[model samples]
Target chain A: MSEEPSPGPVVDAAFFRRWLVAAAAVIDREADQLTELDSPIGDADHGANMRRGFTAARGAIEKEPPETPGDVLAQTGRHLISTVGGASGPLYGTLLRKAGKALGDSAQVTPEQLRDALKAGVDGVAQLGGAAPGDKTMLDALVPAVEALSFALDKGAGLIDALAAARIAAQEGALATVPLQARKGRASYLGERSIGHQDPGATSSALLLGVLADTAEQSAAGGTG
Target chain B: MKMLINVPETVVADALRGMAVAHPELTVDVEHRVIVRRDAPVPGKVGLVSGGGSGHEPLHGGFVGQGMLDAACPGEVFTSPVPDQMVRAAAAVDSGAGVLFIVKNYTGDVLNFDMAAELAEDEGIQVAKVLVNDDVAVTDSLYTAGRRGTGGTLFVEKIAGAAAEEGAPLEQVQSIARQVNQSSRSFGVALSAVSTPAKGSPTFDLPAGELELGIGIHGEPGRERRPMMTAGEIAEVTVDAVLEDLRPQRPVLALVNGMGATPLLELYGFAAEAHRVLAQRNVAVARTLVGNYVTSLDMAGASVTLCQVDEELLRLWDAPVATAGLRWGA
Candidate 1:
């Protein structure tokens, strides 16, 4: 049991806002890829849905800048819930809103705070959608992210390192959904044919977590300034 | 791969603007993406509200007016509207009588509408909800959720809206809507895939000679895919599916709807085949409407809806309706 200090930066309201903006950009950049994946199993609007939802969320955040990290996330959640029109909107919106609500009026979020916030988000999504781990939804990615965050927090890692671990876990979880048969939403209608395709919702969720990881790392290193 | 949309985010808003300009009598809420009767909330009359994603045009929006929906909220393409829009629309349309919400069976729509109803109830407004699950494609077994709500929704909106306009109590209006849902059945097939505006691409890949059967309103994958067949054959299958689910022996109202990309000529041709099939089966045809009432972005497909009509239903059907998406005189 070696005692090694975790290396990372603190996350604040500005970082949370950046995370959302980056998430929108990431969705825009990967919109075609998402559509391509969706063409096989769905109506192919995954990319369009994410792009519209994130763009609207970003615009809302910019229009009314939140004073606290929770505020930023809450506002983003509300925007996505209202503007995006599919299952993803409400699921993601609930995630953000619950997380923001957990964070309350805090300007900065510690690793434990983020872990609790993520748990809140996960609980919120589960309540809203009734989706489980193998349902082939964003929950697949988010569940793993929350788990990884909790693991890092338990190990006494800092916010940045914990977020990085969560990002990796989310990416792996997103990839895992490719081979599993979809059991919820429109894709479930295909039955066995839905297998072997990456879920668009999981992919976008992974992107969001990855961007948050990057922002946390940057802030930790004082590179955001 | 086939569509004509400028920007994904702007499509619904721009369309509402164009609709407002074309039909000045209807009021359009560009910000909230709601269309309402110019003289909304008739005194002492119950208000009716319905909405869904943006791609299904002339649907919720088109049915908003004198004898139909008091207001319709438009969500993003293939998405359910947020609670804000629903609450706002409910508030806008609520008269002294109350408000009736017409929601499809989709999970998102059901959840958001429920939230909005709660919000409205909190504000001391009476609100009731009716869920439409008319598509007979998916089974309502324990394994799967249930059949989706589809083209039959148009009939419910029209008939229920008429009932509401006639000063039916909220309970009666909801009951009428529920009866229409129970008596109706629908099925659809797609010749090609539709492209969403934001994604700027098609939702699914249909080969040049293949078709998808039993598709949902949101371009969800259907029951099966087979080599392309003639319009008569497609209509036969669609009618058979609907009839199988409905087992109708009485006169029924029929709607052969074009799913965005299909032309009027094809719809009429399909309708003719459906008429023959239903006639051969001894099911009386009370009324018929063949057009693009609800649509999936640019998907090339058509859905057949059959609603068993009684005397009361017929009277409601013939009631006056005037709105941006639909129009007819008393």
Candidate 2:
């Protein structure tokens, strides 16, 4: 049999746990910034929403550690839906729940599987919000990030490289929203006046991918995300 | 938080708990944070349910008695209630005639209510929905994915609730709600912003002499900001916008609703000016109202909604009704 080099570290329950913890920490630290970003275009609750949602996820994980990687994500998703209010609650909740559900009961997650699960989550968010990429929403960041992650992985990039690509794509996508006029969410009410402001939802989506990438890198070294 | 709340997390539940005791005529389900008429799901009458974030008090809750809403599902402040709450409220209030949901057009409100409607249907309860998007301040806003629902929500709820109370079929009540939405238009102006307890800061800063025009109930920014104007100028701008949108040649019902923190004395003065402006445009104001009926927390502003009312809507508007926030000819 032809010898094939081993791939990067597999995403297991521990990886997801660490990933969620990292995500929560990042959100907690950046809450005010997110809220400030939203004040000009939203209800000024994005940061607070994320803080509450991720805190609930963290608390739930601590109280009842989930069994499978999917279970951990699913629990976190459920908690976000309940504790977080506003559009962010249902939108982000859908993302996690869809991604988690896509993982099924698998004990180990391949890079391809993670990529596909993430796409599923992105699809769910778009469908629920009825938003498109240029709508200046979280999808702006998420769609590009998911596309980049899958593209990089399919081209034989390592898991760490793929996550890095995704994070960069997400960040760039968030920045690109600065010139766009929102067509969805409360920002849409501003219409043309909405231009010149970075979309808060996109900014948070970038934060999400940033943590995911950081977790992947740390996981390679047997460290926390 | 500087506001009068035990804690940020406890705001919704605690206020609802107080409401339960405060109004024996209403049944407050603190477990799910729903308020229902004590005689909810009354036999053969079609039940009406409406709710959104909780900060807009005396709305879905205070209007949860008599000829308003049969049930009100209050979510956390400015956050739409979850599907579970709405589903439970629907199940609890649905009579054989079916239940109707009066939903604001905010994206969160629409999505959550849509989910609950599906859940309610799965449980064998018939349901219909009416989306009120009457705010002409901006076609869409940060909080609203489409047209923001504002003061017109009160008119739709009250009028439709009255129809359902008189044993109107679900379709008729839904139609009434839709008509009210189509015929009504609203605009608001804010002198300041309010702080959510969670944020512990004003949503946005408005320095002296500047005002946010076309504001909504969420205390989000308005369409434009301008120097502070005289009450007469404010009245003229608000009324002119409403009239332009509706272009009503017929008599209309006028409601001047205050954002929270506006004094009644100031509101009445503003209302008088708005009436004068409407008359200047040769618009006949058949009915007029002024109050803090619909609010946006502590945002100091007011919105004006004018509806082209027909005989049917007029009769419904005059119907005897009793609620914590509204009572007339009861």
Candidate 3:
């Protein structure tokens, strides 16, 4: 059996902001790949839409850095909603905004706080998009991330450990969308033809969770070293 | 993967610029991606606004002018425009009477337009919405979301734009638009998939010998794929599908639209076959139009839209309209 790692420290507002910016870059780097996957089922604009949205979010966050982690996420949400111009915009925006609201005015967020925030974010997305788990949307990734985060927190894991768990779950969720027959969005109009393709939204959502894991790990190493 | 474009990022802006250069009467807002009539929101007239993804050129944008849309917000290719753009459009086009939003029934389009209407209402502008869900290929059953909004948008825009231009109240224009939408049916097929400029690849894989039937506008796979058929057989299948969906008992206005790559010659051939099939079924063809009114980038295919016409619809169809993409009556 492999040895388990120790829990890490809490994450602060600046760390969360950095993670948001890094998430944008990750999306930019992987955009062409997302577009390629979308070519088989969707209009090949997922990359362009995500790039525009995250670019705007980065700009907004940099201009007026948030005092709290929640504020940073809220600003990101607003930027995406105004600029992305697609189904992804409003859906992803709702996710960030709702998560941020749950974080409240706290400058630093603990693992349990982050878990609650993710739950709020998932709730917001469901309310705004009316999409459930098997709909082959961002919700697929988001639901898994939330479940993993909650499970880690219950086990007394720290921020870094929980985020790592969330990242793994999110990636698995994204992969699961490949064989799903889309029941929502424009892809659903294709019926059986939509099967055998990965969902672009779920892929992007997984990247977001992965970014969080990377940032938390880096922050933890910097703090303890 | 061939496309006629200068740059990927500037496609919509460049197209709008070309429109302005080509038509001096229509005012184009390069920043907002909205095209408006030089003199819009005619005093005491209900303003009409319609828009969608940018690739369906000569649509919401082309239909903006004196007798059609007062304004149109162009989104990025195959993406819905945000609520802020629609809100700005509503504000720019709102007269005292109110503003009418003619929206396609796609989820993104519906949600964004609904948000914009709410924003406009909050700003003291009265607004009404009419969703166009005219594609009969997909069903609006309990199991599925519903039929997608497709080709018949042009018919609704033309007729309702005319009604609005003639000083109809916002409610009247919206009601008439809904009536037209309810009476129309559209079905499409794709011979080849389209390529996005940024992606530089086809949206789907279609073998040389096969074609996708019952396709939507965004290059989404159709209901079925089968071996390629002759233009005559294709038209028969398309017309038969629409006829079965609408089951109209009256005269109909037929629109045979190309999916961008199909040339006018092929469209004419398809229309000829469509006409023959309609005649055999005893379906009266009141008016016929064949062109690339709505397209899916460079996809090689065509769609058939039929609107059951009454006296009022026929009058609206003949109404004088002027815009950058289409023009009639000097």
Clashing pairs in 3: none
Candidates arranged by TM-score, highest first: 3, 2, 1
Clashing pairs in 2: A186-B141, A186-B142, A186-B143, A187-B142, A189-B140, A189-B141
lDDT of 1 at A176: 98
How high is the CA lDDT of each candidate model?
A: 0.84, 0.87, 0.86
Candidate 2 lDDT over B1-330, as tens digits, reads: 378888787888899889988899999999878899988788888899999987887788988878889999998888888888888888888878999999998888888788778888999999999999888887534433767788888899889989988999999999999999998999999998878877778877788889988887887777889999989999999998888889996889999888889999999999999999988899998888889888888889899999989889989988988999999988
**What is candidate 3's lDDT per residue for A1-225, written digit by digit as tens?**
014645565566788788878988999999998887777768888888999899989988888898898998888988898888878888888788988999999988877888888899889888877789998888899899999988877886766777888999999999999899888888787677677889998999999999988998887787741
TM-score of chain A of each: 0.94, 0.95, 0.94
Residue A187, candidate 1: C-alpha displacement in angstroms: 1.9
TM-score of each: 0.93, 0.94, 0.96
Residue-by-residue lDDT tens digits, candidate 3, B171-277 = 89999999999999999999998877878788788889999999888888788899999999999999999999888888999999999889999999999999999
Give the Å shift of residue B10 in candidate 2: 2.2
lDDT per residue for candidate 2 within A1-225, as digits (tens), equals 013423566689988998899999999999989988887777777887789889988988978889888888888888887767678888998899999999999988988899999999999999999899998999999999999998988778888888999999999999999999888887787778778999999999999999999888888776432
Candidate that beats the other on lDDT, 2 or 3, i.e. the better one: 2
Deviation in Å, model 1, residue A95 alpha carbon: 0.7
**lDDT at residue B171 of model 2 (Cα atoms):** 92
Off by over 4 Å in 3: A1-10, B140-143
State the lDDT of candidate 1 residue by residue for A10-38, as single tens digits: 57888888888888999999988887777
